[model samples]
Target: MSDAAVPDLTELLADSPTNWGKWGPDDEVGSLNYLTAEQVLAGAAQIKKGKVFTLQRLIGDPKGDPVWPGRNPAVREMTLDESHWDEGNNGPAFPGGMHCADDTLTASLQGSTQYDALGHVWYDGKIWNGFDARTTIGGLSKASVAPIAERGDAGRAVLLDIARHRGKEYLEPYETFTHEDLVACAEAQGTPIRPRDILVVRTNHLQLFFEKGDKFYSDFCEAGLVYSPELVSWFQEMEIPNLVTDTIANEVTMDPHNGAALVLHSALMRNLGVAFTEICDLEKLATDCADDGTYSFFYVAAPLKISEATGSPVNPVAIK
Candidate 1:
């Protein structure tokens, strides 16, 4: 398809408001319900075409401190004599009966709570343009919301590593990123910001969470780093579809005592048709794009089919 044939960002957002809605932290389960067999084929074709880079975070336990908020529960325990299977009730009953197996598996990618699709959240109890949330995906189903499928594919994606562009692997506590920062990063990379792009930002906070141990979550909550309201307004004006990042909450951590939540979430998912992606791995892609001066790519994501659940585990990929 020619570039001209590609839908404009505003048109894409207007036609599929829920497309931007799938990447949020609080989007309703099953709000993204447009997964068609053709999308799966398109993704498979990209993989076959090569030059595609995988961006999903590895879903295994790391030996060091917790990479996220939860503990690693995959360690194996020593087996006692009684725990071993006896070959003989009185004598040897089976050959290989004395063998032992680990039988333990670690969980990666929290599926029980997936990223909310842009159509997932609603302001004034409604989604974009007064679509009722309860009657939509937020109300009846868990697999996907209306217009969005169980999985989503076929959109333009762009990466803006704000922290990296600032020459740091991470941002400081409570630092609010601005629209200028985003534009500056794109400029530095020589990639102009375009509308209808699925934008991914790298804070490198995931690495800090792994390094800080127990202090990570508390410190993050206290730091209050996030996007400003103006930035949200900018996205709506630009008509961007989806936004993905490495942070779990998709906004600056709130004040623990005050409970001030992510205003960006309210502005994007609630007001505009933009959604978010949390816990993404953009380090390698960002580094490469920054060096090569190419940041646009074909993006795709697939969510598991867990009925009535808040969210399912997803593995989203990007092809440059």
Candidate 2:
């Protein structure tokens, strides 16, 4: 179909489900509310081996940090070093003339492994939980990532190595999966996705980005969950608090069925209030899970507390 034939997001998701007002009118974290203390305890119970894996990709990797198109990778510039304290030079004189290195980083908050606030995306002039889009004018005054960072997120997490499940090194561009596919992948991995579990999926798609450089963006659709009404409903029923994936966006770049861009962003995040944790490096976690035949683990992620920001960088950990 031509671009003109595709329905607008409003029309496409007009009748879709939403959790707005389900947690009350002022709720900012959305489905994350499902992560109760009971859930945290349940997650802790899964940590039998004490093996820990960090999921954040390097901020300034020489190989190149993969990010969403139109965003630049992070850059760290050193401001003070040993040279600053050279013979005649002075570096921050203290009681004992102490010297230390200092640096500053500049980059988009969502450039690396991140957690996007509920208000990051929207349609019909409204954001998550019926907040007006104007609330995001200067900065996200409503549904910002600060609330999530303040609260923190921890719970049971299950890894679904979709690439390995299908016997591929990595999923191809525009490759798609559904809730059914997630379930099938989990079953094949000898586990089941419990309700309120943080879903971590691995595709290792960035391997191509590191290998091909700019050519990776020539056709930039990512391999991830595709949106459908049934898929949205499934997420609603499952009470999933967070969706973590090794992809730029947590869903396919464009809906293959309707040609809509990041449909799940609006459907699942905006409507259902599901938190999105994207661009994770799940190689270590997936490798351990595959080797041990244990896919469930205790997952904890605490993003930076930048007020009213759309997202924040995070170094999540998975313990088995």
Instruction: Assess every candidate by TM-score.
Output: 0.66, 0.98
Q: What is the lDDT, from 0 to 100, of the residue 18 in candidate 1?
A: 31
| Cα lDDT, model 2, residue 100 | 87
Q: For candidate 1, write residues 1-320 as lDDT tens digits.
A: 34555433333233322333444534542212222454334334433235666666655446342333553423435434434555442432347656444444334424221355444544445554454667554343421332343445456566788887778868766665667877888888776776555677777766776667566667455222344445655776666666677766666765222244565565666566455566777788777777777777667875655444333455677876
Candidate 2 residue 35 C-alpha distance from true site, Å: 0.4
User: lDDT at 215 for candidate 1?
Assistant: 67
With a 3 Å backbone cut-off (N, CA, C), the pairs that clash in candidate 2 are none
lDDT of each: 0.55, 0.94
lDDT score at residue 33, model 1, on the 0-100 scale: 26
